[model samples]
Target: MKLTSTASRKLAALSLDEIKEAQQEASRQFEEFKARGLSLNMARGKPCVEQLDLALGVLEALHARSEFANSNGDDCRNYGVWNGLPEMRAIFGELLGIPDDLIILGNNSSLQMMFDCISQGYTHGYSGCEPWCRQGDVKFLCPAPGYDRHFAVTEYFGIQMIPVPMLKTGPDMDLIERLVQDETVKGCWCVPKYSNPTGVTFSDETVRRFARLKPAAKDFRIMWDNAYCVHDLTDEPDQLLNIYEECLKHGTEDQVLIFASTSKISFPGAGVAALAASKRNIDDLKLRTTVQTIGSDKLNQLRHVLFLHDADGVRSLMKGHRRILEPKFHIVLDALEQELGGLGIARWSHPHGGYFVNLDVMNGCARQVVALCKEAGVVLTDAGATFPYGADPNDSNIRIAPSFPPEEELREAMELLCIAVRLAATEKLLYERAE
Candidate 1:
């Protein structure tokens, strides 16, 4: 049978002979792909060279000697402004919907800030609480198919991670509400807007529920990594309810720590990062920073302030990113639809924004699929990297980072990936049948 005609049928409905034939075809295509010597990567959610080029003007935003000084007349070349420049804080404050006083600008990495937050809690503890290390069996809630780096940070500190299922609206709130009743559950990791891998934006109700949460741990905090707050692909971009705003209404603002960065907006390595929290939390964190370092790179912060100017400038630049990235996402989604839509072996996200396409292949077949893709010269994010401790119990979810590869390479990579998915699915089905 022609694969195109059978493509719409579920694999379970196929006869044994048909399954074998499909497997043979996939193997043939896989070998052909290997012979082509293709070296394409869809591993990390890194911006492409074209996206990077969009920020070329930022490098020259501080070309003159006078430009080194911030709006306050403070020369950015020297240290002293630990809380970052006032104007720089204003830019992030507008973007994040938080007051400038509540925002603490950091280095280029929000991940580093997140780690430091956890580290501080681990080593020194939050106010009125014992250090996390002293608390017997400290735990954290990790929404599954979540950001790997978030899990990595928690894991590095020996924090027990509890995998909460991610729902269409957001993480399983019911489970989180129940889990947080345990005082040992110190915090949770969240990517509320266009969340990593899955691209599931939390609903307004979800945000409200988060704000109203009465966790047993007074020190329970939400690591709100709003990494894709401004990254939109469609004219109708996803709107994430301002968690901080919601928290304030419920008087739970101190429980949420918000993080965002210009890593994707500008240069990834040379961008500015910031954290927003309640005044109490901010003051506590500021005190820690005094001992940590004199200050972050204010010069880079000034460049970002001059370049991005404000929230509107950030939006304009993201539109350019969408233009380049939107097509790439289409390439991956369209291929998956065309090749594996009704195959009953794979399903993936159609993200409006964010840098990854979350794909779930047949259970017990994801690792095999990734391995097959690698052998055929296409690299994908590790199959289990989406979960806590790098373990996906179902072993089905895969993160496809389409931003880094060129369109043609991405197209080729997706084609190979589809074939691998089919081959692995068929092999698993055949083995199960024989058993």
Candidate 2:
């Protein structure tokens, strides 16, 4: 009973005979390394050429000497107000269903804006308060298997990172509910829709629970990064619960902050990013940002607005992305199915949208598998890069970004990756058999 219990607990742990049989079968297929002429990368979650082709009109509109005036008539080429051009904010606000005044515009990437917000809290803090840099010992709760950049920012500021397990619907709500009780927990990172790597979306109930939570610290915030807000790779888009409405209904309107951007939709390095928050939170945050910078570039925002007028316009763009990207997703999914399906060695998500497809290899084999992929002229997002601190505690999770490369390249790289996974897993099984 004890031996069976141990064996079942770890699919990796097994007897010598079991591993020997696995290796014997695998060794038959291990051809000596051959020189190849392939140079491929399946790493970054960037948009493909065809997907970027959809937004060429935006670039054409922003050509030199155009009507580059803001709603307030500020010249697009010069410094002006800090809150961004009012018309641009209003346009995206309409796109996201929030009032324009509540949104703070930022250049292209929201990461710079988020980093600034967190840094201000570190230096001077929310609303003329004592900076955390002075207080020394600020900490944030990081949902494990989260976006690494989120963890990177908090780590850069010397903040302690507490890892919370991520689930299909969202981060573990029970753990999140209990941990934020401590005053040290300043915030939690979230990607509410079709989360990176895993392709899991937060349920409406999970969103509701998040909005209703009462943290002990008044300064506690939920960094609601909805990067994939409109990124649907399917013909039918899944309806997302309006987080702004949910927070207001649950009496935690002031407790959460929202972020969204048009990077994947329009142009990644050329799109606009915004933050949506309660009036109180906005009032508090603006106190720090208003003085530092003149404002975001109005010309860029205007281009986004002129090109994408409403929510429907934005949704229409996503449908285009879905068409070009869907086949590429199929390429990887089909490869995994043909090579490793029912092999009991690996499993990967067939995401409906978002830039990543998370893969889980047999435990302890991720590193070797990734190495083999590289050796065979394929590059992958590093093994453990998905989890906090660049360490997958389970060492099983691997992020697959299917959006960057062309379908043909993705197919080749994915094929090589599967061969590597099988080889690594079989090697693992054989090692177990020896002992």
Candidate 3:
């Protein structure tokens, strides 16, 4: 699909009469959308049925008669392998660019591991440091338009969240460096590669800056969530600097804790999650986690190991994922281009990989747009959800998750989304005129 050039005049430039006409047309389309009674949702970044079906081998990888022991002869049927299966760790280590000894596997959710890390800081402290719960008014640096679940965890713990601007390259490093100077600032959340909603991969320089951070707090950490490290949608994928290596260079390897998983690559609920940090951090984490449970499901770990044998196997699997995801994303882009292109009221990112397309409609129009879509039987992730504390000062950003729906549904959803955006912008403009 050919995109319309931006050379045309913006919506804000049109005369009162032209704006009225546009508003009337948009309102008509919105009503027609409502009449269709289409229950479409583009809210969460869930893999499509076909993508999940590709990993059905994982279910059959193990059985009652299968080998219950790992290569090290550690019986997976009973207790032991406290950290994780050695071969599984090695595979994840290779995939995440970390040493196997520094990596530790958890159950299914990397987010849970992240919460535990923060909980550890709050409860027991890190490497014998003072517990954050005992500390006065601890704060966390949150890069705006970030993952909502990250914010949710911090909020649940009652940690103050400070919003820092996020750019196409990465978070604003200058501000981050300045903010960490406060002793009360305990940590920062990061989604380095193919980040949550905007899909902004941190540039080499940004990562290097993160590594060299000189914080006032002894336990300042960078929660590096590399959830989409291998979820590339193109052959020549965007490269991300290795945070662990960069931290090693700066002699601050303990300052970063990397999190990753096979959630999108395979089944979401049954996938494996892992954390890679400094030996000291890993030791501290293990000491705290020892009280939680005996060990993670080694049987499930064995299944993942058998299904996706190595880094090469994971890469090949991701290529299959791209074939399904790339077109869905394209449908969204095409619809946006054909409908709202050349209209200065909106702008969106064209990510090479990641599950979402970040759309920034006209300021103050996002919530109205979302409401309009919902009223028309289409649901979107609420406006300002990407920001810390559910606030977007300008209320512009909207994360579009195109992966869950089928191709035709995605096309229709995008069409409705575009119409909602236009209608909201039109309404806002008319109201401004009246005022």
TM-score of each: 0.98, 0.91, 0.98
Flag clash pairs in model 2: 16-433
Off by over 4 Å in 3: 1-7
* Top model number, TM-score: 1
lDDT of 2 by residue, 97-189 (tens): 688889988888888778887887787775345777876687888887889889889989998888888887789999989988887778888
Per-candidate count of clashing residue pairs (backbone under 3 Å)? 0, 1, 0
How does candidate 3 fare on TM-score? 0.98
Residue pairs with clashing backbones, model 3: none
Q: Write the per-residue lDDT of candidate 3 for residues 1-435, one digit (tens) a residue.
A: 111333286888878787788888888888998999999888999999999999998999885556688999999989877899999899889988899999999999999999999999999887578999999799999998999999999999999999989998899999999999999999999999888888899999999999999999998989999999999988779999898998998899998999998999888988999999999998999897787989998988999889999989999999999999999989999999888989888999888898999999999989988988899888999998999999998999999999999999888888888888888887888899889
lDDT of 1 by residue, 1-435 (tens): 545567768987898899889889988988999999988888899999999999998889888656577778888999888989888789789888989999999998999999999998998888669999999899999998999999999999999999999988999999999999999999999999899989999999999999999999999989999989899998888888888998989899989999999999998978988999999998889879989999899988887778888889898999999999999999999999988888899888888899988999999888899998998888888889999988899999999999999999999999999989888988888888789
Angstrom error at residue 207, model 3 = 0.2
The candidate 3 region of ten consecutive residues with least summed lDDT is 1-10
RMSD of each: 1.0, 4.4, 1.9
Could you arrange the candidates by lDDT from highest to lowest?
Answer: 1, 3, 2
